[model samples]
Target: MAHPVDVHVGQKLKQIRTLRRHSQTDIAQRLGLSFQQIQKYEIGSNRIAASRLFELAQIFDVSPAYFFEGVNGANDSEVTPCNTSTTISKALAAIEDETVKTRIVTFIEDISGMAVGRQG
Candidate 1:
């Protein structure tokens, strides 16, 4: 089975690639990989080497850590081993319509307010 962290990184990689309007073929060509290989990397079916990951980060113009942005257990101080960032990132990535994105943002804001109210 693929590791959860690897899966999360793969999801993030796909999300960033989509957000940047880069196609699998385009990215693969740049990396000198087959599109199928890119797909595997995006789907977490294959483990990306550290060196290749660095190369990907360059292609995306981000640090290698960017691929692990939503991954949990990155820090020792964070309470609850939850993939909060990953969840949010995935949710946002699924919203293709701008109007839907606006509504989702509003909903999140309202939910955040409710949580704060409960705390207060």
Candidate 2:
């Protein structure tokens, strides 16, 4: 089985790449690797070395910690709330539509205002 860290890293890489509107071929060309290699990295089939990870971080304009956002060094039996929150936050951050963000924020604000009005 692949390591959880690898899976998390791959997901983050894919998300960032997609957000930046980069194709596998583009990143492959920039990294001097084949498109298939990039695909493998994005799918967690390949474990990235520390130096290579740093290079990828540079290429994606993100910190190495970004790839490990949702990972906690916990046993399988232990549930880490931070990891779950991080995963949700990462997904939310990937949303690129400004109008969507504004709508969601306005909806939340309206709901909060209504709750406050009812309480007062």
Candidate 3:
């Protein structure tokens, strides 16, 4: 069975990669590995080395610790979707109609009272 820490890290990896809109092949090419290897890493079937993790951090423009965030408190029940902000950002980006996009943003801002803070 995959270790919890490994699963968490893999989840983080997939989340960030999806947020950046990079295909598995893109990352695989940059790392000089096969897409299958990337898939394995994303599924927690293979553990990432510390050195490779550092490389991934560089590619994603985040700190190495980013992959480990929320690990301590995470449980199977907490294994939900990617970060809400990331999902919202992706959805907003996909809207081709400016008017619809604006309305969606306005709705969110209105309901949120324009509050700015880290999401839980």
Candidate 4:
């Protein structure tokens, strides 16, 4: 099984890569690696070393901290990705601003409560 942290990092990596319009081949070639290697890294099947992670951050024009930005406050000790709507993930993937993402989450939570209230 993949570690939760590894999985979280991989998901974030994929989101950022897609948001930046980077092909796996492009990232692999830039890193002198195979596309399969990049796929593995993006799927959490392979763990990225610190140095390589730094390189990826540079390639994406983000800080190394970018990968871990939304990890905390998930109401779980394990930093696994949230189990929400796919729409939410897609929406978040398009946004590079952490503050905006946080606001979106809050908005979703507020609306979700109203949905529950109506259902009840």
Candidate 5:
């Protein structure tokens, strides 16, 4: 059986890949891996090495902390912090409509502006 952490990471990878609008073949090519390897990684059939995870973070344009979101370290007692930014990124991926993307971007910009105003 695959470890829970591996399974979670794989799911996150798939989600990120889908959000980026990349096919398995595309991601495989970018990673210099076979499509089968990408599938295996997405399904948690294969464990991703630390270096490979770093590669994936770069490919996904997300911080490494994104993968650790909702993850409890090996100690099982130390739960990593949840990164809300990743959730936004994932949501952005599921939106296929260009108008929706534009709207979301505008909304985010507005919110950021408000935050900056508050800070100032």
Candidate 6:
């Protein structure tokens, strides 16, 4: 069985790769590996070494810590490429200006008719 941490890391890899529009073959060529090897890394069938993880971080222009962003958060096992919440969170995180982020949040709330800061 794959370790949870490994799976989470792999999921992150796949997510960022997709967001950056990079194919498995692209990443594999950059790293001088086969696409199948990239596939295994993205599926958690094989664990990534620290050096390779650093290389990936460089390629994606994100910190290595990016892979572990929500590993300790609730419902981590449900994190996947298709998760809208995860996608939104990533988009929000990419925005450096707090004012822009707040406005975007307010816009989303307005369009969705969801009250911000209200919990059921």
Question: How do the predictions measure up, each by TM-score?
Answer: 0.63, 0.63, 0.67, 0.65, 0.66, 0.64
Q: Model 5 over residues 1-120: C-alpha lDDT tens digits?
A: 877677778778887787577899998998899999999998778999999999999998899777766777666544453346557777787788999897787777777785455432
Distance (Å) between predicted and true CA of 116, model 6? 19
Ranking of all candidate structures by their TM-score, best first:
3, 5, 4, 6, 1, 2
**C-alpha lDDT of residue 69 in model 4:** 63
After superposition of all CA atoms, the RMSD between model 1 and the true structure is 7.1
Report the error of model 6 at residue 99, Å.
26
Residue 54 lDDT in candidate 1: 98
Encode model 4's per-residue lDDT on 60-86: one tens digit a residue.
Answer: 999998877667666534784644533
Model 4 Cα displacement at 24 (Å)? 0.5
**Residue-by-residue lDDT tens digits, candidate 1, 46-94:** 9899999999999889999887664456653333323464567667877
Least accurate 10 contiguous residues by lDDT in model 2: 76-85
Q: Which candidate leads in TM-score?
A: 3
Clashes of each: 0, 0, 0, 0, 0, 0
Q: Which is better, 5 or 6, measured by TM-score? A: 5
Would you list the C-alpha lDDT of every candidate in the order shown? 0.76, 0.73, 0.82, 0.79, 0.78, 0.83
Which regions of candidate 4 are displaced past 4 Å?
73-77, 80-120
Kindly list the per-residue Cα lDDT of model 2 for residues 42-87, writing each as its tens digit: 7778988898889889998889888776666675322223444445
Model 4: how far residue 55 lies from native, Å: 0.2
Q: How close is candidate 2 to the true structure, as a TM-score?
A: 0.63
Please give the lDDT score for candidate 6: 0.83
Candidate 3: tens digits of C-alpha lDDT, residues 56-116: 9999999999988776564643544446756776787788898998788777877887845
Off by over 4 Å in 6: 73-82, 85-120
* Positional deviation of residue 56's Cα in model 4 after best superposition, in angstroms: 0.4
Q: Model 3 segments beyond 4 Å from truth?
A: 73-120
Please give the lDDT score at residue 91 for candidate 1: 73
